[model samples]
Target: MHRGVREFIRWVEAHRDDAEIQLNPPATTSDIAALEQMLGGPIPADLRFVLTRFNGGVLPAGELLPAGIEPGTIGHTVREYAEAVGGDFLDTELLLPFHKTPEGSLLAFDRSAGPVSDTWPVVDYYQDLDEHRLMYRTFDGWCRVCVAEWTSDDFGADFTLETYLRSGQRHAEVEPDVATAHATVAHALKRSGRPADSLAAYLQAARCVPPLPWCDWEALKIAAILDDEASAREAATRLASYAPAARWAQRETSPGRVAEVLGPIVRRSGDPKPLLRLLEQLKAQADEEEGPVVEAILEALHAGKDLPPVRPLREQSVVPHVPDVDAWWEASQAAYAEGRLRDDDLLLDPDMVRLGRLRPFAELLHIRRGF
Candidate 1:
């Protein structure tokens, strides 16, 4: 019932059916209480206000957090946080991710601001950079800012296609920072269901930004969402310069995931060679669960390629006729070297060939992903 939350919710309801707006059904009071119980605290009044009004909805601004914080929700408000409640990332028990900035930072609540029934201050948590900073005094203030950002002259003057196109017609007279403004415009266009324009705007934004991998990834995503092969290939080709393997090794990234996204686009719109090369390099560096992710990608990339049959590990071995311990010392060095040759190639030998995740990518593979 907070005025700010109430206002935003009303605005959302009024526009929810608009092709350009996005939103979900509101949650019940009981559902809110249940979530709070799971979260081991009282839900803040304003935060609850959003959830109650829209179980989770997409506004022209951005998608809202559902009661469960599923993939498409506002922030990285994962259900996993409930169990990892006291972990390093979830450092503050009272904080909960509520929204995401266009640039991908998360806006979470400083639940410690006051009691559950009271207002909670908002904090900006940079998901990629692992940085945190104060953003607004309260959720109410944040919503006002967001609403203003949508229609305010400073932010493209409008969130609709007509306004954006009109403003673009006078590009020199409006939107000083062409790249960032276009990117912002792209989001609005996307929400409005004009995906083709959104993709173009995203491409423009990608070009404006530095050769950053994330932006390229986002561009690729936008293109894939629109099912535009050429744009996806454009993003993929850019993504190659920054080696996926090197990047994955240095940071928390998922080449396998990227492959899953790009595979289909490549299949339809472009060549998968560059993407396959990127995946191969990353697979060389990837291990464990990512192994399967890479495997899945490889399978998708070259589903028709004949693969080596699965090899069994630790199977019962037949003892070959040998000189026995008498010649052990004499043959040990040679035998061990030979055994090394027989064993799995620990070296990144392209042809050393034992079935690791990627069976030595032969062809450029393709994959497709929805936005």
Candidate 2:
């Protein structure tokens, strides 16, 4: 195998037990030949090298398509896409599919680049937009980017205040215009009990050109928490007065959600009149789905009943934990490593694969076989 591909294999193997890193066994010589025959072209040298050592599987960046003309294989998918779109973009000679985005868009090698396959650039084909854009100049370049993404400090890990801080700093430095990143940091800070810092971050997000409404929404919540009447009024005015054309604004600045967040604050102040008036103004722009929710909030206010607590952004996990799955996973992995448990054996044990740590592998297999 090529040295770079070998190093990637090593890194993946090191993380084999991780639920996120699913990889398949290497392809045989015949498998490579079959894929080449199906495509009627040579596979790029670097990609071919990697496939011989580790036939495509799920990666942190996306699903790497395995080689073959079989269902779910790279060649088969390329042909299928070409037929659907009626374009030369997915033509086997013009481009070769290698990966699929999380949304199922194809990323392929641009064979039109040159005679040499290894120098072919990678293009991200947006299925929805019917557009393709060059992403990387070479297969190795794409691989390096994927590796860097996975190796990043917070990759595949739950967010922590420290991670959020690091991410906030990086996003503020690298992509200062992205309001969502700033808002993420603000949320993390708010959750960590740093209202002042959180408010600052939210303000920064709101300062972005064409600012996101959610930033202002968050600022209002923080201002209410701090009892900063002026700041609260400013944020509330922004949320209630401005009209946003984007579809996302409907959900982001939903009056019902805003009311819930401000419920306790208004109750504490012994005045629901101001908030009720604000919601009434926002109700004009609320969609069908949101109008009812806002109406419910208004009814509760009129009845002098305490509003429910703010619903969390993400629902808490309700999946029951399996008993000693950790210990079973260790033993299962050990058995597999010793060849006591084959891939076929693991496949048959659907519960173990689905409920246990082998979920990633099962998903990969399902994709590969088009199950």
Candidate 3:
């Protein structure tokens, strides 16, 4: 494998935890060969490197690839293609389908050019028309294309801003403060150098998630860049409210944030009395329920060990509140206190979630819509 490709794989591994991209693990060399052999074509060097590393997964390429054609691993993709279009597809030098387009067409590379050129041209093959149309001169070129707008038509591009922006917008509407979806839009706009537009997005993010340190921080920076003194001051004030949420924020979150939240004043006072008082208060709160989790938190505090923090902004989530949400919470808590429930019971409980105070460790659960 090329050193550059290896470096890219390392980057992918580092970022696979990001929620936006659906990255699969790297493919074994033998797995890559099987996929290539299944397609009856030697994969191009750049394309091969990416496929081997990512094994085809949805990337942060906004709008270019529609949600319909989710990138699948080479092995799964080829198997599906074969099952869909029998043995004859292997012989065609017409289109090498890599992505399934939202419009029910196949986005592929024109294999006919592969033999002559070091890099093959990309094409969109419409099976209904039995024709393939050139889209880009090379796979490398397609990979580098930056989508500036959104459209439903087949004007031609691998990534589109439409789907990505729409998804973020939907998430922001639902879980704004919890998940920081608006921040995704803001960050993308920043990267595209649309500072004015990015500032607008950051403002929306600040509104949706007022306590987000990054939103205020980014807004503060962007406002200053735009020379908007009023906006910068407003952002700085909001950032101050979040104070120490961002203090230990590395990338997204860390255990230190929890310590900071619980022990900040106690550590400064130099009084064990206050610390004990705080622990007594927490214990009183925990009196409603006590499991291994609360015990661990108390023990960690006493031993000067780190406790977990609140859910990371990007990973925080919430659910719809039915009228019965309160009732369900009460019942679940009682069940837990009585040892009538397991972790799975709380996890599967409709009222219990990572955002709200359902249990002692509710704040630390992975952010998702219902467990």
Error of 1 at 88 (Å): 7.1
Ranking by lDDT: 2, 1, 3
Largest lDDT belongs to which candidate?
2
Which rank order by TM-score, best down to worst? 2, 1, 3
Worst 10-residue lDDT window, candidate 2: 362-371
Whole-structure CA lDDT of model 3:
0.48
| lDDT (10s digit) by residue, model 1, range 78-170 | 443433453543334546777756666667786666655356666767655654555565677666656555554655453454555544433
lDDT of each: 0.53, 0.64, 0.48
Best by TM-score: 2
| Candidate 2 TM-score, C-alpha based | 0.43
- Candidate 3 per-residue lDDT over residues 229-250, each given as its tens digit: 4555455444433324334252
Candidate 2: tens digits of C-alpha lDDT, residues 16-51: 788876888888788889888877778887888778
Candidate 2 vs 3: which has more TM-score: 2
